[model samples]
Target: MLALAAFFSGAALRICDGLLPRLAADFGITAGTAGQVVLTFAIAYGVSQLVFGPLGDRYGKALVVCCALFGCAGAALACAFAGGFDMLLRLRVLWGIAAGGVIPLAIAWIGDAVPYEERQATLARLLLGTLSGMSAGQLGGGLFADSPLGWRGAFGALCAGYVVIAVMLLARLRSMPSAPPAQGGRLAFFPQLAAVAAIPWARLVVGAALLEGVFLIGALAFLPSYLHQRFGIPLSAAGALVALYAVGGLLYAMAAKPIVRRLGERRMVLHGGWIVGAGFAAWAVAPAAWWAGPIALVVGFGTYMFHNTLQTHATQMAPAMRGSGMALFAFCLFLGQAIGVWMAGASFDRFGALPLLLLPAVALPLTGWGFSAALRRRAGAAAA
Candidate 1:
C-alpha cells in the first residue's frame, strides 16, 4: 500500500520526461526550454528533502509520508489544470516538494524495522514500486498525451492514483501502533543533519549516489526528445520505447538476490557501471529508435545494480537518525540530478544529445571503478 503511494509520486516526477515535446509545442518554446520543468521539479524535490527528513524523524515517518502523499495529490491536480507554462512549472515545483518525502522516508521506515543482513533484499522488493512507477509515467505520458485525453489527462490520472494511495495509507496508519517523536530541542533537526553529514562513509555514499543521479538521470531526461528529432518519431512512440528503461529496472528487482549472491557489492558496482556505459554508447550509435529500447533496458538493469547497493548502505549510515540520513542521501542524489539535467539541457541546446549520451557512457564505468576502489580502501583500513 505504501509502495502504491510511492509509485504514484514517482510517476509524477518522471511524467514530464515524456511530455516535454508536447509542452514545447503547446507553449511555443524549444524542447530545451520544456526541459526546465524537470529541472525545476528536481531542484524543489532535492531542497525539500532537508526539511522532510527531519520532520519525519520528529513526527512519525508514516504520518509524514501520508501527508506528503495527500499534498502530491493536490499538486498533481493543480498541474492538470494549470493555466500556462509558468503555472504548470509552479505546480510541478510544489508537486516535487510534496513527492520528495515519500521514498526516502519509506526507506527510513524500513530501516527502522528491518535487520541489516536482510535489508538489501527488502529494499529491492520496495524498488518494485519505484520501477513500476517509472514505467507508468513514461508509458502513460506517451500513450495518453496524444489520445483524446491529452497531456493534461496524464497528470489527472496521476492525481487519481495519489488520492487512492493516500486513502489506503491513512487507513493502514489508523490500524497500526505509533512511535513517540524523537525528543529534541527546537534546534534539534540541524544537529541530526550535521551528524549524518559528519560521517566519512556517509559522505562517500551520498557523493556516489549524487553522481549516479547526475550522470544517469540527467542524460536520460532528454532521450525521448533525442529520439523524436533524430528519427522523426512521435512523442508517444519515443516515450514508450524509452520506458523500456523501467523494464530493465524490474528485471533487477526480480533477480536482485541471485545477482547479489553471484556478484557481491564491489563487482555489482563495477560490472553494472560497465554494462550501463556500454548500453548508452549503443544508444548513441543505434540506427533506429527500436534499438534504443534494448539499450535502455541494459542501462536500467545496470542502474539498480549500482544504486540499490548505495541505497542499502544509506539506510544504515546513521541508524539513530535514519530519516535524516536517508533524506540527506536523497537530497544529494536529486540535487545532482537537477544540475545534471540543467547542464544536459544546455548541452542539448548547443551540441545535441549524442555528446551528452556518450559522456555518461565513459563516466559511469569510472564511477563504478572509483566506488570499488573506495570500498577496498575502507576494508583495508578497518582490517589494519
Candidate 2:
C-alpha cells in the first residue's frame, strides 16, 4: 500500500511531461511557458517537506502517510475540475504538497526498521513501484490528452487511484504495528534540522542530492518534449518512448542487490554517473528517434545507480531523527529540481535542448566522482 502511494506520487510528478504541448496550446502560451506548472509542483513538493517531516516525526510515519494520501486525492480531484491554467497550477501545488509526504516518510520508516546493509536493496524494490507509476503517468498523460477526456481526465483517474491506495494503506495501518515517532516535542523539526545541517556528512549528502535533481531531473522533464519537437513524433509515441527510462530503472532495480555487493556504493555511483552522462550525450546526438529509446533506458539505470546511494545516506543523515533528516534531504533535492526546470525552460526558449542535455552529461559524471571521493574521505576518517 505504501508502495502504491509512492507510485502515485511519482506519477503525479511526471503527468505533465507529455501534457506540456497540449497545455501550451490550450492556454495560448509557449510550450516552455507551460512548464510553470511543473515548477510549481516541484516547489510545493519541496517546501511541504519542512512541514511533513516534523509531523512525521511527532506523529507516526504511517499515519502521516495515510493522511497525505487522502490530501493527494482531494487535490487531484480539484485539479481535474480546475477551469483555468492558474487554477490548475494552484491545485498542482496542493497535490504536490500532499504527494511530498509519502516517499520521504516511507524512506525514514524503512531507515527506522531495517539495517543499513539491507536498506538499499529494499529501497530498490520500492523504487519499482515508483518507476512503474512514472511510466504510467507519462503514457497516460499523452493518451488521455489526445482522447476526448483530455488532460483533466488524467487527473480524474489519478484521484481514483489515490483513493484506492489510501484505503488500502488505511487497512494496512490497522493490520500492522507501527514504530513510535522519533520525536515528540513542541519545538518540532528545527533543532533536528539544525543538527543535521551542522554535520559535514549530512551537508555533503544534501548538496549532492540537490545536484542530482538539478542536472538529472531538469533535463529529464524535457525528454518527451524533445521527442515531439525534434523527431516530430506524436505526443503519445513520445511519452511511450520516454517511458522506456522506467524500463531501464526496473532493470537496474532487479540487479541492484548483486550490483551493490560487487561494486560497492562508491564505485557503483561513480560508474552510474558516467553511464548517465554517456546516455545523455548519446541522446543529444542520435540521428534517429529509435536510437533515443535505448539511451533513455541507460539514463534510467544510471540515475538509480547514483540516486540510490544518496538516498541510503539521506536515511542515516540523522540516525535518531531520520524523518527530519530525510525530509531535509528531499527538500533540497526537489528544490534543485524546481530551479532546474525553470532554468531548463528558459534555456530551451533561448538556446534549444542541446545544451541542457550536453551540459548535464558533463556535470553528472563529475558529481558522481565528487561523492565517491567524499565516501573515501569518510572511510579514512573512520579508520583514523
Clashing pairs in 2: none
Model 2 lDDT per residue over 1-384, tens place: 667888998889889999988899888998789888899999999999988887888888888999999999999999989999999988889989998899999888888888999999999988888899898888887787677788889999999999999998988886655566665476756877788889889999999989998998988888888889999988888898888898899898899999999999999889999999999899899999888788888889998999999999999888878888888999999999998999899888889999889989999999999999999999899999
TM-score per candidate, in order? 0.97, 0.98
Runs off by more than 4 Å, candidate 2 = none
Model 1, CA-based lDDT: 0.88
Taking all chains together, the TM-score of candidate 1 against the true structure is 0.97
lDDT of 1 by residue, 108-149 (tens): 888888888888888888889988999889988777756777
- Give candidate 1 regions above 4 Å deviation: 176-180
